[model samples]
Target: MNDVIIRTEGLQKHYVLGAETVRAVRGVDLTIHSGEFVAIMGPSGSGKSTFMNMIGCLDTPTAGKYWLDGQLVSTLSEDELARVRNQAIGFVFQTFNLLPRATALHNVELPLIYAGVGGKERRERATEKLRLVGLADRMDHKPPEMSGGQRQRVAVARALVNEPALLLADEPTGNLDSTTSEEIMVQLRALNEAGQTIVIVTHERDIAEVARRQVHLRDGLIERDFLNSTVETTV
Candidate 1:
């Protein structure tokens, strides 16, 4: 761990559900340094999802401050948040989120397209990331043409195309079989070991075990945050 890539102080998010106000996250203070691999875990209604949204910049918090890669992001405007997300953070979802008609290379180039990178550069970058994820041979294949794990590998390549400061994955292996799930986790572990700062929101204990640290959220607060005892990594 080097620089502080993620920091949240008294982070909170509340939702208005007609007559009821739901406090999805309440006063969570957390910090994840550069090169750290962390997992956020909890059962249903435990606030892990809400907290992940805040971290990913997909949703703004109702209160508190958050800094991503040392930039205060909690108060960023929607457009500004969008820019920051595109440049600084990369996201992976369980659904794969690929365009069924697009080739893996083109799908990986989507973020660069949003960022206005040149087509040539975008292709080059996407190509490099696809190779990084061991999907070089499948770059020309579309989502519908690939297997579940391969499609998710394409998703991973897409997430890495931007060279983001943080890689955030939410239930990344939820749709995969147990074997495929392990494969994704192994990929994530390899990425982290190679020094890509990573964070994942997963409920699977085996998946969570792959991370260097685990934070368990419950009833809108962090119930536990600690380094993996078996890994021997510093806090």
Candidate 2:
């Protein structure tokens, strides 16, 4: 009723491994509205990763319904799903998935290129996004030449370049130190404040606390869904 951006009803994912059918997500029901910042927290082997993949449109659920921006994702074909993924979602991974050989600007411009954006406009838009993330000066630098924080910043810039409706980050801070992780969190918080819907999957409590709402997963089921006490005022 609240203008849901993502809704899942009885979502389930199962994998068959050597005669064993393992249920990764067991009947998950969730609704996240626009402008919400949510965190999925769980220990290793939990279904959080599977859930994130499903939500991010990277993988399809074995069963159940997934409505993204009011459209039933499970009904879409592979090509249709790819289009929806490009138009509606942006993803940030734990490993800064930048093209090591490409410059920061180039990495950020990849999405636009895939969408067939022209050269001039792509460069201009990429520059603006990188600047928004405080990486304007590093646009020409390649990932290997930059620090971990800088690489992550570039990744964030890339995630935002398309102006997607949803940003899905998987353990975004897993590779960074505490200080650097906080810095990236600050950037993500700012994006959420700017009305970007975000769903982050993380195992670290401190990182999860940065979000306004936290959903805990255990043994392929949601154990808790609650609001954070220390609301992100800075965002």
Candidate 3:
């Protein structure tokens, strides 16, 4: 079996604004292996977000190919893409996207519910994931009852309930303080160490340093992709 969880060749995305065409991603190529932790960093309008969307199956490219776990998803229909997304990807965004009225367990159970899992099994799975994120004691707590970090942990737990093949985090630390950001990063780092393949998009250099590899983009194209020998071991 192939270990390459993500591979893209000559990937391109363009947008037309009136008569002018904006080239968002210009023939970019990338590959990420299983269990690898990678960070994509770039300034505003650098196409980092666009690239993330493409790889996450949230958007399609105008040109080029995207092979996710050896499956060509760039050409999949909307319904097919949604199916692939639910089965293969977990997303953690800056906003912690939790239901205000739901308990952490219920929030985590949402994904499994969408996937047609039974009530008993969904509860078991959600509970296990919350435990993995160090929130076993907070299963019954609602979003309003938790701190920002705790809410983000709930979001992380929710993301993992479906056992996705890839975890895509977009500016996960953007809404947290420095200390809380590190706290979240610690949990994410632990998850990666336990064999979760993660691709995080961040513009903060410190946040990006936690990953083993970094890919930088500029003007809609890759500027550099290199191993980070000095990746921080601590959150």
Every candidate's lDDT: 0.92, 0.92, 0.93
- Top-lDDT candidate index: 3
lDDT sort, best first:
3, 1, 2
Which pairs of residues collide in model 1?
none
Worst 10 residues of 3 by lDDT: 226-235
Query: Residue 129 in model 2: shift from native, Å?
Result: 0.4
Clashing pairs in 3: none
Worst 10 residues of 1 by lDDT: 226-235
Stretches of candidate 2 off by over 4 Å are: 232-235
* Model 1 segments more than 4 A misplaced: 232-235
Give one digit per residue, the lDDT tens place, for model 3 in 1-235: 2399999999999999999999999989999999999999999999999999999999999999999988999999999999888889999999998999989999999988878999999999999999988999999999999999999999999888888989999999999999999999999999998999999999999899999999999998999999898867775
Superposition error at 35 for model 1 (Å): 0.4
Cα-based RMSD of the predictions, in order?
Answer: 2.4, 1.5, 1.3
Evaluate model 1: give its TM-score: 0.97
Off by over 4 Å in 3: none
TM-score of each: 0.97, 0.96, 0.97
